[model samples]
Target: MSETLGRRGFLSAGIAAAISAQFAATHNEARAIEPIERNGQAKFKYSLAAYSYRGLLQGKAAELTMHDFVSDCARMGLEGTELTSYYFPADVTPEYLRDLKRHCFRLGLDVSGTAVGNDFGHADPQKLREQIEHVKHWVDNAAILGAPVIRIFAGHVPKGGSADDTHRQMVAAIDECC
Candidate 1:
């Protein structure tokens, strides 16, 4: 169980729960999101961003872990979760990743994906390459987690840099990562 979840986290989780309850009330006949059938009608599944629960995950309420995040999502009847990369241990290991995936599976939740903040808009070529490598690393991590999507941020233009040049650098960096 979550430890009080702090006042803010508790309030936020309660609000999310209330919204989920309202949605469930409206879709009383909704089918469980797992075991998708190709021939069945398309339906959207909800996922919560781990960033939304940063307070519980990493703030003073740091007793919370990613497993708790997944459990909370399941309790809300969510189909998936977005495990943002910033919250992972500094020295994340393959065992840790596999455990997370297993936990999500046990809870009938999908990892959905992870996210990374990047600066492909770096003015310097070296810095841009570093950003690209960073993205690639997360790409590998996401693959291990069986996450189908990874939301990444393309940083804003650097000071004194033209928008066009920054766009070019960002595009090139993305190309390299791809």
Candidate 2:
């Protein structure tokens, strides 16, 4: 009668049990770590960055909104986040920014930093000023979002401009920002 029960059912049951046992063992191993403590006090730490998800937000390819990206980070056990400027909609308002912050808090995520792509090395003063103004706005938004760092980029040199001139212009633009 035992032999007639067939080998397939027994093999399937054995495999399922083995998989379940492996999962349980892994869970137990994870739970075995003692809570981090210093001098009998538990310490909390957080880290996250926008660049970590750049691949998911590539040009014209991103399917997820900024909020969704943040949520995904939270799901991954991250306690902090950095936002890229491209993720923001064109008509971002103060209320919208506040809502974003509130959403992060609800998800237990902190806004650690912001990244902007403005470049201020143009030869035309007006263009340079415009870029600077754009970057300043981004910095303000970063502050509003509770970001400690705001990344900016140096503008690319025109084809006719020498590398040395471009470097000088970039340095001047950075000085202007300061």
Candidate 3:
């Protein structure tokens, strides 16, 4: 019994040591990718989409404002970001857009674009027009933030509706925004 216990303990210690060594190796590998700053320049550049971190934000793991999100992007070695309208405190204002641009500039991260959530496939002309206006509003905000692209979505096709009609409505909305 004593010999069996000693063998089991030795095996357990060996397994623990192997796991610890693997953990240390993995940690060191991650650290090797650490951002480097030389002559006020970073060695690597990447882009982050706000949607990528939505789980953290909505889960309350992190209370991140737009500015804070941009800073986080910089810290993660990202040089660009795609801003989501949901993260903004309110309707995009010129002042707020300016501030966001400034914050990104200070952090050395560029606002690559804005993701505007607008569904413009409504059957009602009035509703479609409203959604178009919403898209244009975000496009304007994107322009203010020096974003080159504005991501837009085509709303779902309603059941029992003509596919042609839905396509026409989407085209009209696109024209209106343009």
Candidate 4:
């Protein structure tokens, strides 16, 4: 059975996990994150983001792939992992996505989420539409990979464009992406 969470639920889990990881790292403490108890059961989980291995994957440190990142997280005993989209090859196919998901499943890790870099501040309607389409494509891939949340960001405002206008454009682009 697929264990994918809904977007909102996954966002909540991913954010809490990220904050917990940061706190633990900076404080040099054990995994002391207190779980949110509900009916005497823990509600939150801890995860490692693949982006944390960016330098290694991008050739700045050591050679690695997303699969290696998953293995490292499993070795570190994380409960979930965020598969950052930046490290994926440009021509990623459905077969590749299926393999990735299967690998995570075999390692007993949740595909916490994925992320994309986008600019929705373009003044040109065509450009904005293209950007939305690009994001939508990733959304489909995320679903296929059993990932619940796909984080997207509105880039810096275009030169001379008003913040209000950019904000509206971003909203429109997001709406279309959804």
Candidate 5:
């Protein structure tokens, strides 16, 4: 009888240990799967938008150049600025990009990103391909400028095209660009 009692106690202990181990493992996995909130208040480096100088960029009223924009960003205590592609010359060379990057670095500013207008929702396949190519070109330019991101836009859907088709086409175009 005593032996029977000892065996019963040992078996019960072993079962309890196994159950506890499983519970611990499950608890850790549950914690690991907890959703992350990315929209909460988080400190980020301040950046300026070169698009704000549209008038200057277009040579309308002010003649503030891209270099001047970078200098102004530095003077205003900004960490970086978006270099909009619209303001750039059509004949941008590799040397020009390198020099601009160096100038920004010298001024303690970063080329945060570059923005280019893209219309991926066009019904015409040729137009869509052209837009995709345009985006791709800017992506390379952004890399050359040492910019970390390239902001792209999908224009409004064409009159005859369905929203779903347009969305799918945009996704495919972006995939090709990437």
Candidate 6:
């Protein structure tokens, strides 16, 4: 009876030890899964859209230039920036675009993309053509700025227009832009 009691105690101790080891291993794994900056396994890059600072970026009273915006993004440890077209000076030249690209590169940031406000669902042929031209203009600007993408919006249905017509027009406008 003594021998049997000893064997039962040993088995219980082994089982408990095994469970304890497993729990410890699992706990470490959980800690490992907490997001680690610059970890090779991390698949995401962070960027800020310039449109986020629209209030500070728009109108005659606006304070921040695109360069200032980029500096802020760098300070915030962002990897990239999306330069919204609206904030650009009306007289933006190719040299300006190139200089912006240089500034971004010097600060260790990529011009991830650009955005232009466009309404592809315009019911009028002239309006839709204008929207397509607006998008194309941004595409040209993005290329000069070393940006890889342009964000565009498909517009709301124009008054008295059916959803189907708006969708079709949007698709056609997108095709034109392409």
- For candidate 5, the per-residue lDDT at 139 reads 92
lDDT of 4: 0.86
Give the range of the ten consecutive residues with the poorest summed lDDT in model 6.
34-43
Q: Tell me model 2's lDDT, rounded to 2 decimals.
A: 0.81
Candidate 4 lDDT by residue in tens digits, 85-175: 8888778899999999999999999999999878899888898888888899999999989998999998668889999989987987888
Q: TM-scores across all candidates? A: 0.73, 0.66, 0.70, 0.74, 0.75, 0.75
Report lDDT (CA) for all predictions: 0.87, 0.81, 0.84, 0.86, 0.89, 0.91
Name the candidate, 3 or 5, with the larger lDDT value: 5
Write model 1 residue lDDT over 1-178, tens digit each, in one string: 3666687798999999999999998787575466656887779999999999888777545867888888999999999999998878868888999999999999999888899978888877788888899899999999999999988887889899899988887787888877
Q: Candidate 2: where is the Cα deviation over 4 Å? A: 1-48, 51-62
Of the candidates numbered 4 and 5, which has the greater lDDT value?
A: 5
Please give, for residues 10-104, the per-residue lDDT of candidate 5 as tens digits: 99999999999999999999878666888878878999889998887776455887888888999999999999988887778878888889999
Tens digits of per-residue lDDT for model 3 on 61-168?
567677878889998888899998767765557998899899999888888888987887787778888888888888888889999888899887878888898988
| lDDT (Cα, tens digit) per residue for candidate 6, span 75-176 | 999999999999999888999999999999999999999998989877778988888988998889999998988889999998888999789888888887
Winner on TM-score (2 vs 3): 3
Cα distance off (Å), candidate 6, residue 75: 1.3
Model 5 alpha-carbon drift over 4 Å, by segment: 1-43, 59-62
Candidate 4 is scored at a TM of 0.74
Stretches of model 6 off by over 4 angstroms after superposition = 1-39
